[model samples]
Target: MNAHAATDTAASSTTALPLKEQLVLVTGGARGLGAAISAAFLDAGAKVVVNYRSSSQAAEELAAAFPGQALALQADVRDAAGLKDLAAAAAEHFGRPITTLVNNALVDFSFNADARSKADELSAEELTAQFAGSVLAPVAAIQAVLPSMRQAGFGRIVNIGTNLFQHPVVPYHDYTATKAALLSLTRTFADDLGPEGINVNMVSGGLLRTTDASAATPEEVFDLIASGTPLRRVTSPAELADAVLFFASPLSRGVTGQNLIVDGGLVKG
Candidate 1:
């Protein structure tokens, strides 16, 4: 293991950094876990920029709920120009650098095993498509924000991942492999950016009960997963979002380049 993982929480202590003191950016934040994370940040007193690829109405409504504290930005994470425009808009709207970023805008993928491409049948195109969302987009977003984060002398970046990478009970090959790549990038970013006062980390969750993606999942599958977990229930988007807040808060300032699995203890990392 890299020493960066051990050093991530070397500064962790009781209490938390003030959320109101931070400017935050959340990708794909219009709905689902993204919305939950955005709401949590707003409640914490931070100014937020909610980025979405489509779902304009939902984004508008979410931003409206927070009034002046939040703004809805339409940007496809895979587009460099859009990501840059988003950062610029956020800075202008909030009058400060974005101090925190949550890479939650997931590429379209069904969680159903039947719907997924098996390793034997999966193609290079499938892997590349997943990578576009899982890894490439994150790299673009980080590049878009790095100068501002460094200038501010503080930063917090949280990447959304899946517990499937740790335990591929169903082996969603393309999805899990992309996330595994992302996990590696998380640690790499933490290693490179830690000294610059930026903290990079990942929060991986198990199958969310009823997100749009998982709504296709069979009830029996949910039941089976729930029965297997110690908590006797799969995680909810809202519940997992709360855990994400910890990474953005000062409470985890010493933590970085590490993956926090929030899967009801189903698969202990």
Candidate 2:
């Protein structure tokens, strides 16, 4: 489906504020797609914790726009203890356990093919770093939230991923490999947490039209991607952000361990 149509579908499918009385913690929620995701939940009348590792100014600025509905905090997701502190801080700030967790924090990796290391040239350290940042970070955050989720018998965990794995038009080895592992973790978590009323899922996006990271990509590349998609345009961070809301809402209470690809039909789910 086209981006607009997909959004309409999501809006109709959403349950609004199934967790209206609870809090949401979005890792890397300061900028890029993370910003949109945080805003979406806030617009739905949910309080949010916008977590950032370094973008303090940007994070605070964004949080200011929402006032009491949102707050910005800093934590490196790669640190398990740090994730614990983040969850504690967020619960203290909102006076509630976080009912939703979005693992949107990303490691420092570039989409520039020339700068990316090929399989043969990629270092063990590079792969390990990506894993720690992407996979282990979410694992830590999930672990941190499990106690509360179990207590309440409710939770939502959305892991942001790339649709590149579905369409490997670009050889982003390290980034894609880490996301693949994360996808696996998403399903496993879903299975393990289903009985406890926790849902784990993934929202994968293709080349976003323009984001801080994709800004470096050539315009010609964006046009090429747009032309190939059925929508004849690249997906926007806003659209992907809306898609991420699905799993968090009660509309998706019955859905888990699923990957929804939002790439303008360039890559089918």
Candidate 3:
């Protein structure tokens, strides 16, 4: 999933376009893993629209690093109308339709097991917020981009998910449940959109070594998780970002509805 590997390749399928020729809209592409994803696409020569709800300064800085190739636009992914405006602004600025999307926006949450609400303690409000970010926002994002993708007959949608649904080692009730729902939507979207030449997929990761959200995780816990994995190391944001490129690139044109885990062999699927 190196930049050159994705950039040097020819078209992978009849409708699959090269990475350099694509314009990508990345939701919450301002910081943490989102920033890494944005950087990966930019490095692969793709024009990127880095959408941020708040982190305006960080978003602007990331766009500044890429000059004309990246634009930091503000939009709340939870709002469909806002997302539509985001898509329009991106296409207007880039002068090309956005053929790729990375749904990596995350609601405020920490990975500290002790801090997470237990099943019995989880509130309806917590579940609702998670659902808005995980399931509803993605639906809105897809709707926002579907028109252009339909017009071009090409699209790549990558949903950011977590492996907790499969292993549930910590059982983050609200967060894990919504992400599992997202995985289901990923498959259904793939089936519904495949005929139109669009690929919808998910990239699930275990607790990353250190993202802003996971910064609260204990150091010993990271060491323990790493030791359990065959790779004997926690996955980095850059490493997971590379896996995302696989789905967004022509490499995965024939693939859809699959959740590829990028947690250094922690959960083999």
Q: Model 2 lDDT vs. the true structure?
A: 0.85
Q: Global lDDT of each model?
A: 0.87, 0.85, 0.92
lDDT, residue 86, candidate 1: 91
Alpha-carbon TM-score of each model against the true structure = 0.93, 0.92, 0.94
Give the best candidate by TM-score: 3
Write model 1 residue lDDT over 114-195, tens digit each, in one string.
Answer: 8877668889999899999989999999989987687677888999999988788896888888899999999999999987
Sort order, TM-score high to low? 3, 1, 2
Which candidate, 2 or 3, has the higher TM-score? 3
Maximum-lDDT candidate? 3
Give model 1's TM-score versus the native structure. Answer: 0.93
Give the distance in Å from residue 15's predicted Cα in candidate 1 to where it truly belongs: 13
Weakest 10 consecutive residues, lDDT, candidate 2?
11-20
User: Which digits, one per residue and each the tens of the lDDT, describe model 3 over residues 1-269?
Assistant: 88877754533454678899999999999999999999999999999999999999999999999999999999999999999999998888887888999999997888999998887888999999999989999999999999878876799999999999889999589999999999999999999999888999999999997888999999999999999999999999999999999998877878999999999998877
C-alpha root-mean-square deviation, each candidate = 5.0, 6.9, 5.1
- Which regions of candidate 2 deviate over 4 angstroms? 1-19
The TM-score obtained by model 3 is: 0.94
Mark the regions of model 3 whose C-alpha exceeds 4 Å error after superposition. 1-13
